[model samples]
Target: MMQTRRKKLSEWVQQLYFIGPSLFFFSLIVLIPFVMGMYYAFTNWNGVSNEVTWVGLDNFVTIFTGDENFANSFGFTVRFTITAVVLTNAVGFGLALLLTRSIRTKNALRTIFFLPNVIGGLLLGFIWQFIFIKGFSAVGDATGIGFFNLPWLGDAQTGFWGIVIVSVWQGAGYLMVIYIAGLINIPSELMEAADIDGANFVQKLKNIIIPLIMPAVTVCLFLTISNSFKVFDVVYSLTRGGPYKSTEPVTMDIYFEAFTNNRMGLGAAKALIFFLIVAAITLIQVVITKRKEVQS
Candidate 1:
């Protein structure tokens, strides 16, 4: 019994040795701040002031009742998330299908496509900003194409689409890599059997390839949804949530509330609400997709 206790103690020490540093930093950086933020959410603590007055649910009530900017930002975020998620996944899956074939340039094309994802979001946004403002204008003038001639970022509608385009361009490549991994793992025997059974490309895709790739689909959808919802750096660098704040996401709204407006307590409330919303949406998505995976 003493030897067994000693062994258990030794195992505990080894586990602590491995996990202690990471847990300590996580507590300091994430857990503690999160707890403190929850506390601040109930107080009226202007960021710079030491006087924190407890306001109970006032911040939350104001947010739900009268915060027009927050509502507007949330609306924009929802629309952007929907549009970006669909386009990014479609393009990514399409590219994955094309690249997985027997092609001479597949490797090079994969690398080129994925290159944009590696670039910093701020830098990518700036590069695309210049392209939309200057390069598109020059191309429009040269080609006389009405599509290219439209103001890409000058108005609310165009500004919204501009962000969507950049987001899709940046995200699709990374998702393509995920799809490629899924595609490559599918057994060759399955394809051979489908061909032997005289299954057409579309039929085989519907029945076999897609079902088998459901795990990758679930991952890709979750990633795109969360990333699109939390988008900030790209919007910041590209539009600064502008064309009259038409492109502002909830993240930017929280940021301005906290730092720019100095309403730290209110900002914390907004953040908590945002976290709950995002968590619920992502959770639902995962649950639905996981069901699909199981059925497949």
Candidate 2:
């Protein structure tokens, strides 16, 4: 018993030796910042001067009761999240289906498709901004087609669609890879059995493929939703929430509130509220997806 106890003690010591540095850094970086932010959320910190007074829940109350822009930003985020999530998943799943088939240059095509995701969001936004403003106008001037010449970043509706287009282009490839993994893991025998039973492609997809790939769908949906909700850099680079705050998502609103407006406490409150909303939505999605995964 003494020998076993000594061995266990030695193992624990070895484990601690391996984990101590990581734990120390994690506590210093993540835990410390998180605790500090939580405390600051309830304080009137200007983020510049060292004077921070505890304001209780005034920031939260102001945001919920007084801030019109906050409400608008939240609504815009919701709309963007829903649209982007659906479009990203649909395009991604379609690409996955196409890439999973026997093709001459499937690997090269996959690489090309995924290349956009490797590009930085800010860079991608700037590139797309030029495309929307200059390239579209040039095309319009040359061909007399109004479609390419539409005021993409000037109009609220057009700006919304422009953001959606850019987001889908960047996100679909990453989600496609996930869907491909899920697709490839599906039992070929099941597909063969479906084929033998005279189930067509659509039928097979609707029944077997989709049902079996619920986990991947769940992951993609969660990622796309969260990403769309928190999208800031791309929008900031592309439109800067222009056309009278029409394109402002929650993150941009929070950023502008905190940094530009010098309302760090209010920004922190917004951040906390945003975190809670995201957590609640994600938890609900996870519960539903987990239930589906189990049923499948």
Candidate 3:
């Protein structure tokens, strides 16, 4: 019994050496802030004077009742999330399909496709902003393409699409890498059998490839949903939620409320609501996608 107790104590020490530090930091950085933010969500803390007063559900009531900007931002975020998620995954999956084929430039093309994702979102947005401002104008002047001459980020409609275009371009590459891994993991025998059975490319893709790659689909969808819903850096650097605040996301709204407007309590309330929305949406997406995932 003494030896067994000593062994168990040693094992627990080993486990603590591995898990204790991570748990400590996580609680410190994430859990503590989350709890504090939750407490502030029900108060009227301005973040400056520190006279935190409990206001019950006043912040939430104001958000749902009087905050038109937040509502508009919420609407914009949902629309952008849906659009970005679909386009990013579609482009990524297409790139993966093409790159997985037999071609001399396959490696080079894969690198090129994934190059955009390597750039940070803020930097990428700035780069695209310059391109939309100068590069597009120069190309339009040189090539006489009217489509390229339209104001990319100067108007509400164009600005929204401009953000979408940048987001899709930036995100597709990362998703392509995920898809490439999934594609390579598929067995050669199954594809060969499909070919021998006179299965056309489309038929095999519909019947075999898609179902088998559901794990990758789940991962990609979840990633896209969360990232798109929480997107802020790119919009900040690119548009700054500008042109009459039409492109503002909820994250930006939260930032402006807490820091810019100094409504810490309102911002905390918004942040909590935002977290719940994202968590619920991603949870639903995971459940739906996981259901489609197969054993293979």
lDDT per residue for candidate 2 within 74-171, as digits (tens), equals 99899999999999999999999999999999999999989999999999999999999999999999999989989999999999999999999999
Task: Give the per-residue lDDT digits (tens) of candidate 3, residues 161-226.
Answer: 999999999999999999999999999999999999999999999998899899999999999999
- Which residue window of length 10 is worst by lDDT in model 3? 287-296
Which ranges in model 2 have alpha carbons more than 4 Å from their true place? Answer: 294-296
Each candidate's number of clashing pairs is 0, 0, 0
The TM-score measured for candidate 1 stands at 0.97
lDDT of each: 0.95, 0.93, 0.95
- Residue 32 in candidate 3 has what lDDT? 100
TM-score of 3: 0.97
Q: Enumerate residue pairs that collide in model 3.
A: none
Compared with the true structure, the alpha-carbon lDDT of candidate 2 equals 0.93
Rank by lDDT, highest first.
3, 1, 2
